[model samples]
Target: MIFIEHILERPNKKPILIDLRHNESETQPIVIFCHGYKGYKDWGAWNLMADAIANAGFCVIKFNFSHNGGTMENPIDFPDLEAFGNNNYTKELEDLHGVVDWVQNEFKHDNHIDVSQISTIGHSRGGGIVLLHASEDSRIKRVITLASVCNFGKRSSTIGDLERWQKDGVKYVRNGRTNQDMPHYFQFYEDFKANEERLHIESAVKRLTIPTLIIHGNKDTSISMDEALNLYEWKPDSKLVIIENADHVFNTKQPWESDDLSPELKTVCEEITHFLKQSEV
Candidate 1:
């Protein structure tokens, strides 16, 4: 498989780290995978997932959102908390747009990717980000969301917490895995409020005419199954698959030790490959 890591940079925006994986095929459908909040391109078994999709005969492009906290030097941990704090929905949308634009116009030639046939797969919060992008961007032909959240307005903080955030101008969420206090500036909420209509997941999903696959674990504790049901209800034509006994990460963990995917994640990847292949026809 051909593996290349490049940085997608712009004048003012922070540089986004991107990874492209595929065989020597001259032309193949493209799959752009988006990692969830606090997630990076190399998180857990995602590289393995990308390789699996590539081996299945597609070019898999996985990228880190510019403001995802990991700097160019270290793309895995929370080394740049300021950037993480400044990240908002708008920035993430722009980052996704940037990746798509690069894939369609710039990277296709070098990577032998089919710019015309593009699919996006997002996990958790990235799921919602892809949904909004797919609704607005006609270039995305298919979308697969794994353990995605249905609503962005839902507060991770309480009223008292919001009050404190308002007074302090920022709030922090502790990362249990890294033991870092990730910051969420008040502007993050402000930006979401400013673009509430554009960021509505229900409206976006309703507007999406392309094939969409919603996959969620039945035992997911982070995002409830109702969100998946809500997505299915919003897009009646979209397919929903609930894996029984799987967790939010689909049984995959950080510092993944095994060479092969966990049974649940392997199943998820199989479903994804099947869906993309079927969509091609």
Candidate 2:
């Protein structure tokens, strides 16, 4: 299998990482994964999942968003919140389009890999992104979302909170895991507000003609199961799979414990494989 780390060009000083996993000799399908807000390319068991998908006869490309708070040197956590604050939904969608163009035209993959067959997968906010992008981009043949938000226009209604964020220029949200202050400058709200129409999840999902898979955990608190149901409701042709006992992350962590995939995640992966295969026919 071919393993490569490439620096993708972006307006930001720090270029995003384009991590590729695939066998050069085999002709396989392409799968691009997008990480959620505050998430990186190498977060949790994503690398392992990439390898697993590659081994299952697909070329998997995963990348960190340009302003996902992970710098090129340390592409993991919130080292630069200023970039994060400036990130807008349109920027990320464009970044994903860039990656797709690179993979399909610029980069050479295994002989078995089929560049014409491309699928996109995203988690949390990233999930919403792929959903919206697939609707707009005709090159995307399939889309999958994990714990995706159903709407991009939802914002906190507290006038006082908005006033404080605007007054302070930046607001900090606690990272329960790392215990660091996650900064959200007033620009984040501005970016979201400006691109609300383009980022509308329901509108995108409603227009999607390609096959889609919506995966969510029953106990997910960050993005509730209702969001997944909403996605299904918007796109009735899309398949919905709910993991009964799993949480948001599907029982995996940064320093992932087992070399083998978790049962919940394995199920999700299998479902994706089945969907992709069925689509091929």
Candidate 3:
């Protein structure tokens, strides 16, 4: 397996760090993995999941959103809270476009890479980002969302009292594991308002013509199953899979110690691989 990882340098902008995982000797389809809110590429079993997917005969490109509070040096945790505070949906969408652009240029002539077949799988908020990107980007041939949230504006509304958030110019949400108060700058909501139509998930889903797979945990507390149903309903041909007793994170946590994926996540990976493989026909 060829595991090529590096930081994509950008001019006058935040740099993106991406890892390309696959067999260097064979031509392979590509899958880009997007991490959710307060999420990074290497979070939890994501790297393990990326490896598993790559090992199963596909190329997996996983990366961090430029402002996901992770710097190139320390991409694991919330080291740059200011960046996290300023992150918005529009910036994330731009980051996805940048990644796709980089993928196209960097591997334009690589015989081992089948660049024509591009797919995306995003978790939680990242799922929404992937869907929005797929709606507009013709290069994406397939999409698989894990525990995705359907409504971005509505979801951001839950971030502290709107009036207070505006008055203070920021609000804090506690990260249970890190015992840190994650700040959300008012600019996030401002950006949402500035481009609400562009960030709308349902509108984007209804616009997608490619094969789409929507998977959600029945017991997900962060995002409800109704959101998943909404996505399926918006897209006439999309498929929805509800896993029994799985949570928002598919029963897997960060700092995942074991070499093996949780049964639920393993099942999720299986579903993703099978779904992508069907397109080969």
Candidate 4:
């Protein structure tokens, strides 16, 4: 198998940190993975998951969103909180688009990746970004969302909180793990309001015609199982898999110590591989 990590740089956009995994096949189906909010490509057991999928005979590309608080030199942790503060849904969509375009055009030819058989998977907030992208970009053939948020506008704040946020011009949410006060600039809210229709996750899910898979943990506290139910309801034809006793990260944690996949994440990777293979046939 081949494992390579590189930076994808664009003119005006922040450089994206990406890693590719695959056996040295002449051509193979491709999987593009998006990390969740406050998540990076190399988070926890995700690298193990990518390796498993690659060994299963698909080329997997996992990336960090450009403005996801990580710098090029340091791909993990909140090194660039300023960028993180300014991040919004629209920028994330553009970042995903840039990755897809790079995969289809530049990365495809160079890496022997099959552009025609592309599939995308996103976790948590990334799930919402992928849904919005797949709805508009016909290049994506299949979609899988893990603990994804159903409504973007509602997740940010309550009406009273919004008033306070606007008055303060920023809102701080503490990162329990990092112990850092993460700031969300008022522009983040302004961006969402300006493109509210475009950022509506339900509308995007409703328009998605591709084979969709929704996976969530029954015990998730960050995003409830109800969000998964909403996603399934929006696209009744999509498959919804509920992992029993799993939590938000599906038994995976940051600063992960094990080389082997955690039991729950292993199940997730297996289910995803099966879903992608079914789509292939």
Candidate 5:
């Protein structure tokens, strides 16, 4: 069964959560999936993937970032593109951490999930956030990142862009989905600058002693295969799997395809399942 609800966070803002429960006789491990920038829980084949993982004797929670363009009214798509534009790296990291806190405190007793066996799976930019969190928080026993970026500093186009953003008070980027311009204020850059040291993935990955999984598509155009290699290089113990024909997003779409996941996504899910199970040993 699936339990969906709006959970309140630190600032009193509620983020939607999709909890897939397992009815098995024995207690199961917990896996929290974090969606990346421009992504949500209900996107594409995520729900089906969640069910598959849950059926494999695990409880999974998938949620949206409080500021991830999804409002309480309509938690899908960019209805509030302004929020999307104003989103920053620090805020997303905090939101992920907040979810972790909620899982440990609020959902620990009711569900038969093993609080001590908490693991995380992050997609794209969300992977970066998970890496930082897992390194700092000893609670996370396992970590996984799908097509994650190695660095966030070069995401912006130009050098003096930070100054321009501050002077103008708002900077805009084109959203292909809505065909509209989205505004990102100066605060986004300022947040990164404030936490540059904390945001370093290389340092965090090096410190990670827990089982780690890194999956990437060799054909992914958004984040190069080299980035995945870089992640594996930092943590030699990490398991790295690269799908030959898969592109970014794992060949899924907004509207979604048929019941079958693209060959790439299927492999990705299987790899995750195998790694998580092996981590138990």
Candidate 6:
């Protein structure tokens, strides 16, 4: 297996910390995973989930975005809140591209993966990112979103909050799990405003030509089923999977201790693997 974890550095930019998992003996399809807001590569059961996918015969690459609060040295949790606060949609998009560029060259000599068969899976905020990128990047053959948000602009905007955010220059959202009041500088919204067209998930969804898989938990309180329905509606050909009674993270939690994945997450992995196999056929 080509199991490796390293930080991909960029000139005058935050580095992306990535984890690669797959068998190096055979050529495989590529699957890149993008984590959601306040999420890291090793968050919760993501590593196990990635391993499961990699074992199912695909090269899985998961990365923490350059400004996702984590660092090259400490990638698990919020060690660099300042970076997190400074993060923006355009920056995340650039980070995803950087990861893709790295993967294409990392094992070129061994021919470990067919770069042409690249696909991506994103969760929540990352889902939107993947959609936006796939709309523009022809290299991505398939796209999957887990409990994703359908609209970035709506999620970030509220007339009352906007005025307060503008006046205060920042906003704080408490991370229920970490108990930290994460700061969001007004630039987050400003960035969204500046790149409104490029960052619109709805527009991206409408423009995509490749296959899409929208997965959601019926009981997800963070991002409702309506969002998944919206994606399905926009692209009727897209496959939609609804996990009964599963929460936002599909019943998985941070600091997940068990060696085994949650029953719901296991089912999710099976669905993902199945989708990938059939899509290839």
Encode model 5's per-residue lDDT on 168-277: one tens digit a residue: 88888787976877778777777788888888889989999999999999889989999999999999989999987888888887878688777889888888888999
RMSD versus native structure for model 6: 1.1
Off by over 4 Å in 5: 12-18
Compare candidates 2 and 5 on lDDT and give the better one.
2
Tens-place lDDT digits, model 1, residues 1-281: 88888898899779999999888866788899999999998999998889999999999999999999999999989899999999998899999999998888775566567888999999999999999999999999999999999999885446657777889999888999999989999988888889999989999999999999999999999999999999999999999999888999999999898999999999999999999998884
Q: What is the lDDT for 74 in model 4?
A: 86
Residue 36 C-alpha lDDT in model 5: 84
TM-score of each: 0.97, 0.93, 0.97, 0.97, 0.93, 0.97
Off by over 4 Å in 6: none
**58-121 in candidate 4: lDDT tens per residue?**
9999999988999988888898999999999999999989988887776656656788888999
State the number of backbone clashes in model 5: 0
Residue 58 in model 6: lDDT:
97
What clash pairs does model 2 have?
24-110, 26-112, 27-111, 27-112, 27-113, 28-112, 28-113
lDDT agreement of model 5 with the native? 0.82
Q: What is the lDDT of residue 27 in candidate 5?
A: 79
lDDT score of residue 46 within candidate 5: 82
C-alpha positional error of residue 57 in candidate 6 after TM-score superposition, expressed in Å: 0.5
Using alpha carbons, what is the TM-score of model 2?
A: 0.93
lDDT of 6: 0.91
**lDDT assessment of candidate 1:** 0.92
Clashing pairs in 3: none
RMSD versus native structure for model 2: 1.9
Which residue pairs collide, candidate 1? none
C-alpha positional error of residue 204 in candidate 6 after TM-score superposition, expressed in Å? 0.8
- Clashing residue pairs in all predictions, respectively, total 0, 7, 0, 0, 0, 0
